[model samples]
Target: MASESTTEDHSAVKKPNGFPPLLSKKFGITDIKQDAVKWNKEWEAAIASLTAADVLKEISQKLDDSFFTPQHMELFHKSLRSLQTNVAEILSNLLNNGHFDTIWLLLNAAEQRKHILEGLKRASEDPSTIWGPDCRALCPEVTVSNFLSQSGKGFIDFLTRVAEIFGSPITPAFLPNSWWEQASNLPNPWWGQASDVSPQRQISQSTKLVFEVATITRNQFIGEWQFVLSSAFSIVSDITNRGEGMKEVLHFMENTKGHVARCLAEVKTTFRDKPIIRCENCTKTPDDIGQNVRFMVCSVCKTKLKFEVHYCSQSCQKEHWSVHKKACGKKKVTRGLSGTKGDFLWAFSDSDPVANLMRNLPKKEGRLTLRDIGVNPCNGKRSPAAERQAKMLEADKDVDYFLFTASGEPVRFVIDDLGAKMIFRINRGMIMTQPTDTTGVNAIGEYMLKLMSNYPGLSRDIIIKQLCEEYGEDIAEKIVELEQMAYSSDLLTVRCSVA
Candidate 1:
């Protein structure tokens, strides 16, 4: 026990309530330096056994056995109203040096004194302690209204915030030079808040995101100069089964070219791990940015790909469908008798897949080039000089087009929506003799009938009235009166008309 200085007095003074300073040394708020802590612990056990016959004088004597000075007594008496308040002040001063060991005990004393102050105010509410245990986890940001701007200013500001709340002398070891000036300017690539971060905490939270990216890049770039690398188009092949895939994975381990040097051309390669790509089809254009596409050329085919297809994340690029589907059937030869476009044929040797489509098809009598089937726009009866002069004129004029086989059989051709010609063979004799086998008038009539059946609103005779209105009464009657046209007579007339 600390020995007391008494003036010829065997009588004891009353001890400080609940916390006699010497007995409470182990749990006191003042952060004794380690040497001071060792001495205090040795003395505390000795003081705890004393009877509380005199509360204040004995405890004060025990504290005086150590370096309890007159200055400390004067400060304690002048600043605090009670012993609890005095202990609270001592704890606050220790915390300024950044020690937290006695924080829990100090918190209790502060709360008790705060209650006394509240009682005097007579509202009878329990006042709050700044270090109340319940608050530590729930609060996220501490606002220091005035932030000092200097080198390590952020860290100093943080330290000050802690001192103001707890008590001062927050230990030097507890605060680190915060890297906020450097790191704060960097983007929170994941969009975390900057205010929630603290300079006193152990273990940086950023290792998982940053380290994983670095690992991926290192694994990818290992064999830089080993093989002759060929262009590989991963984008299209990744997106679908119908597209071609990567060329052979070049054995860069066989480094034919200086691939290391080549790859290093990208300054400071960044590897993002487990990055997520929003589905391209689901992403909306930025409301403010307006819509314009970023184009990336495919590595293999040089086909222009949109930023959407290029993939925002590596995982999306990799997890796409693995195999390609065939564009055409694998038959060795064509089925049709024409050397026409769209006719099936043998794959050309050394032919560009994009061109020379039906060039090598087996020649047969009825097979013909489009040029052969197309009208020369000059009569068989005309000479070369007349044909040359009329070429441009014929191109400009509307001519009746005949669809025919190489053998001169007339075939039916309809231009589809996509502008490709679809050929159909029909009985020319039936087409010629029938009053309306494929006449513009019959097509119009069929369309009207379908519309009426679907809609069911309009009155009957709508189609007939429309035809009468459009072509006049004479053509309408001619179309209606014919039960059938005489085939033989019409055929002869048609031949004459053709000749």
Candidate 2:
């Protein structure tokens, strides 16, 4: 169905490598430059037909291949350039219509290109390590691969262009505010706000994109951890030899080290087994069940007593009734369905119920604004007191202060003192303030501040006990409510125990 030149050109291209016969020739074996024109045209057309995912897969496979030689290296570089061009054109077209799926695919393709570049660097440094006899003669030294790897300006430029496209603001013309509001109402608002050009919305979208990119990069780093570490070591070695730009390289090394640590921590946290909920009668959990038999439910306790309990066996329930009878008539401290063991255990775990409450408490920094603390900075529409506070914050922006956390070194902040009112500027536009003592609440505020300052490692149990002893049980409960609010509002710091 095709012409002889077309058929020859199609057949000449190899799987994964995409190298044609013209570019795969050994050193000194020159061919006419014009001969590749037909093959290039055919290759470009074939690439255009393939989806971005397919193109990336091919490139990934090629980068993973172990038979790369100097000849293949040149061809691979040329093929990568061609693929980059094709991807760029596709991305430009997709951008016009805001096709996020295709944009993600193009981003993935760009990621694969970076991987190929890294592979080329590795191949150039140690040719015999990855490739066997096929590449030994052709790549005895770093020549073509080295040049190709170093000429990464083009790839960087392409990535910059892609970022520029993604970073552009989404106006009402692209997506209406009403559409965004409707989309937000969906069960999974994965698209987020598509229209609102507010700083917060833009930041949220940008953060999501960054997180996605970080996830992909983290996966790639894990797959090639050994290679990446070795390369890092090599860079360190280079720095030691030259001693030039050592500080910058050391900083980069520290960031990489931190990144690897975070990745390992994430893996451990994600895959760790859920805590088991044990039975009240035999202290046995679902894990103890030999097969998957359901535990017996206490029907009498449920219908008459309005309380529920579980039993691994009928005999165990009968034996424990003498002790359970006293509490049977009374309301069950832990209430749940008659048979569900986990639900009961969840309500009354050995760990302080308050300790479990810590998980619900916000661990992130709180948002702050002039309006948030009852001050209007714009148009001077504020009381004299509010205006004074705002002016103090504006003046103190340049002053530096130190604050400490459990996890890391003390962070620097800038203090804005408005007499009784004060603000501490921290990272991510977050602000911290001391709790104010309202007329009747002065004692509780003083107690909380003292506890936070004196006992940074104070347990929930200890706090509750102290509060109950000094104040009443009702006051203790109120303290917990206030503490939760304070911690979430960034008014108080809670020391989180490291796992």
Candidate 3:
């Protein structure tokens, strides 16, 4: 990619179009703006003529065909992804601006199908007629989809259908599809169908439900074979189990519809509201001890949900639906009497298994960070690290934050949830004290970082709230001072007054 002469370009290297098509006019309407005007214009143009998005929707079925070699297939993927982006931006604006008239939405889907079908027909009949470096040879041996960007689940969901639309042989996904879930027929530390997975007899009905979903689409190989949908959740729901526990498990299943749906082919007819998920496998620790979670793979979809569980089976995963088939892997796994592992516990390893796992896994997106990896924690004695942590917590406590008068010695405080942030504003005699001198092995810092980084969508507001609730309103108030709560109500005047 040195700015060599025009003669060296891929288009030049291959006689695409038998001659390159002129560059698109700067006005061809391509930009990442999610504006409705752009979307309407683009769609209008598409309705008037054909576009990549439209074509992808139609020929989407033949995604895996010779329509692309690895390189070409990849380019197609990139182009298609861009198209999806365009549609999404357009759609979001429309939704927000109240532009969707049920008919338009319906037409949009149809239009997409038509475009993809047309692309396929053209590729099948006369690939050379299609212009660009992509459509040059009968098959380029390398195509774009192999070389460009792909969406997570959104991309795979679209790509899967594209392959379906074009009659391409669907293969087990070797790669993860969504940020949280890896798409695959293969079960990892989470999903699988055990030989003993019958209804009443099964140990984990929850896991069994999802196993069916993944395996239902699982194609079996038998020379030239007919694919038969298999039942992973053939187990009987225990009829006798109509207690509150069952109700909770059902509720868990209902809220996680999309999650459960991806892994389960058929959600049972919840006789009532789907009970909440009861995670028999979750280890309950006191909130004061720390409710921190780590990256974990789903027992159902193998998606990276922050929480981990000990239950490896559907029934157990469901029974433990209060939690999930995830665990803080800092602890070693041991088998339970029911042939399942106890709750996934947290362990700390200086070796850093998470960083290691990320290093080796296939990279779909070059930009994603630890946000996409599922890693087990390191294991070791908690006391040294814990004590060091406690000491540091103690040191933050020493900063005398409440100084009413310049002459008064600042009232030093143990940094609790409330006064931490506000104390920073008060610069009087503030010193950084070491509760514990161990920096490299600061388990608490590592612990907090792990929680924030790995558990996506965990909001700061929630963290603040949780801290406040755990430490008490006084600590919360001190950490984050409120003008009204501290002054106006006269209620807190009792604590803030210094005699």
Give per-residue CA lDDT, model 1, range 385-498, as digits (tens).
223323432353222222223343432222221101101011111222232333433323332332232333332254455444433444345444331322224323322332
For TM-score, the strongest prediction is 2
* lDDT (tens digit, per residue) of candidate 3 on 1-499: 1122322344433311222212112125433144433433443443335432232222222111211223433443444344334333432332232211111111222232332222322332332322321121112111222211111122123333332422332232222223113222222222133443344432332322222222221111100011000000010011023233234323322222122211121111111111122223453222222444322334433333333343324454466544322442333323221212231111111133332333454455333232222111223232343333334343454432221112323223222322112212111111112312232212222222223323344433443443333223343333332211221122123112211
Clash totals for all models, in order?
A: 29, 0, 92
- Scanning candidate 1 in windows of ten residues, the lowest lDDT window is 223-232
State how far residue 294 of model 3 sits from its true place (Å).
19
C-alpha RMSD values across all candidates: 36.0, 26.3, 26.0
lDDT tens digits by residue: candidate 2, 77-106: 344334334433433433332211111121
How do these models rank on lDDT, best leading? Answer: 2, 3, 1
- Report lDDT (Cα) of residue 280, candidate 1: 27
Better of 1 and 3 by lDDT: 3
Residue 293 of model 2: what lDDT?
55
Clashing residue pairs in candidate 2 are none
Better of 2 and 3 by lDDT: 2
Q: Estimate each model's TM-score.
A: 0.13, 0.21, 0.17
Error of 1 at 271 (Å): 36
